[model samples]
Target chain A: MKCDFCRETSVIHVRHTDKWFCEEHLVASVEKKVLETVQKTFMINRNDKVLVAASGGKDSTNLLHILHKNFPKVEALFIDEGIKNYRERSKSFIKKFCKKHKITLHTSSFKEEFGTTTDQIVKLDSTKTSPCSKCGVLRRYLINKKALELGADKLVTGHNLDDTCQDILMNIFQFNMEKLARTKSISPGFVQRIKPFRRVSERESMAYSIIKGFESNEGACPYVSESFRSLIREELNDLEFKFHGSKVNLQMIFDRLVPNLEKKVMKNRLNKCENCGGPTSRKVCKTCQILEQLK
Target chain B: MVTLEYPDGAKIKVEIEGSLLKVLVKSGENPEEIIVKKDGKMIAEDYELKKEDVVQIIKVGSKG
Candidate 1:
């Protein structure tokens, strides 16, 4: 189909808007929305030490590239979860991308920080402990710890509109009101998190990476199908298919509810986990609890 | 006869006469999660299939 704005053949069909865009316009559209997201939310300052959580996935890779374009000093952090044949490939891509762009990148690992790899954790596979669960907790813990150590003013992620919608739906279904409220809430000893792609769709992010010639099709986590989030992702995609703009609508509803939710849900004041000195609402943080279980 | 090409180099031959979107849906693929290409150029979902047309289906962001 022809691009709505130009003579070039359209490569992207933004369903909700029913608009077609060529490569140039597609990039411009996604970047414009991201820039607006950052500005509208007051997400960063000119001198902020911005660190992007890069996994070499389409989302993060796109995020890192976009942030670096706007903020030349933006660096990236990669966490090797030690997944066999998976994390390594992603790390290699991230390393090459950083070197090419001259952006300093930081590296951490589950092996170094937790004394165990995700591969090892899955082998032990306690009946009550899902490997995905452990990996999620540990990954979040390490990212925050690494971000804090790097003295990053803002920790940015590649979370897109579809991912954000999935998270909101999961939290609502699980009655995780506090978890939802505290997702972006400021707390001591933690780097503030921001998602520039929160309003951009996943497919658009993939298209941007492809058009930029840096998209990696490999490195999908082998155990992704085992997670509850995968199911939520599928369901949300189907809903979005049946009704365009469903994901954005869900985010709009959640955004309106969050101000009140934040006020109502911060009752469990966070305390430092004695073991890790991380912020936690409980006596011990979920990361510490997961680590103990692994042991 | 139309040939469907996947990124993994797998090809499937199907005798279908409809829009690319319909053929994809019939094959149990989600239209939202994929982009189709003809002659190395991206094509819209509603692009109609021709006899013996070979189109590349590049799976997009979604795992589904």
Candidate 2:
């Protein structure tokens, strides 16, 4: 097979666009898409200090690489949930990659900040809550705190097309319109969040990682099996298989609907958490509340 | 003849020269999770196969 753009052999076939690309063209296309997404969404400004949430996974590794290459000032922030074997192994790759690229890397751990790891939290809670539910709260809290302390203008995440589509579907399935609206591109009282790969597929990210020789962590989190997001991801993948471009269309619908939903949901005033002074809609932040439960 | 390689390192040889979709269907592989690439370039399903073309069908999706 030949590349659609040239006589060179094709390396990637994007089904939705019915295009073939050579290695050079494939890399160009992926980078162009990322740049386009960031530009069209107004995800970043020329002088912004971007803090990338690097997980050492394929998506985050790719995100960090793309952002560092394109942006003027970029740094990596990693939240270590203290998952045995997983966190340690993932951090090593993050450290090496950052060092190799000469990008500044900052890390915060649950053990150091909260005096407890996710593993211990899981074992100690009598409610038997899903580990992901607890882990996500703690990780988000720490990430936000670090981003703020580091004076980042925006916090960039590795959320790809599949993940964003799954999240929209999950919220719709649960009929949580408020939560869905909060997933919009910009929100108040929080460091702006951006997803440059919001239009890129997970497979595309993986292929890019392999082609670029990024030392991405290949292991899965131990608690992922019990998360509802995993189930939604599987279902979305099945739907995308049955109907090509389903994920893309889902994200498009979400993008169009978010503005209207935000108008309705934005009325709920956000308040500062008395404990950590973080933005919270309730009397206490979710992170502080979770910490209280642990205590 | 065209060669299709799966993620498991299994290879299937096809004598037919047609689009990537036809090749995938002939190989009995699910097109959803499988992406076809030739010489490390992603090809669309409509890409016509030429003789001696070696294509890799990578299985891609969200990992746990």
* Fnat of all models, as shown: 0.28, 0.48
Q: CA lDDT of A241 in candidate 1?
A: 78
Residue A208, candidate 2: alpha-carbon lDDT? 81
Q: Candidate 1 — which residues are off by over 4 angstroms?
A: B62-64
Model 1 chain B: lowest-lDDT 10 consecutive positions: B55-64
Best by lDDT: 1
Tens digit per residue, CA lDDT, model 2, A1-295: 6888899877566655567677777777778889999998788898999999998888888888988998999999988898998889889999999999999999989999999999999988989878887888888888888898999999999988888987888888888777798887355568888889888888677768767878877666888888788888777767776677888888888788888989987788788889988888888988898899988
lDDT of 1 by residue, A155-248 (tens): 9988999889888988888898888998768888789999999988988877787778884534457877777888888788788778988888
lDDT of 2 by residue, B1-64 (tens): 8899866688889877788778777776656656676786667677888878899876665344
Each candidate: what lDDT? 0.84, 0.82
Q: Note the residue pairs that clash in candidate 1.
A: none
TM-score of 1: 0.95
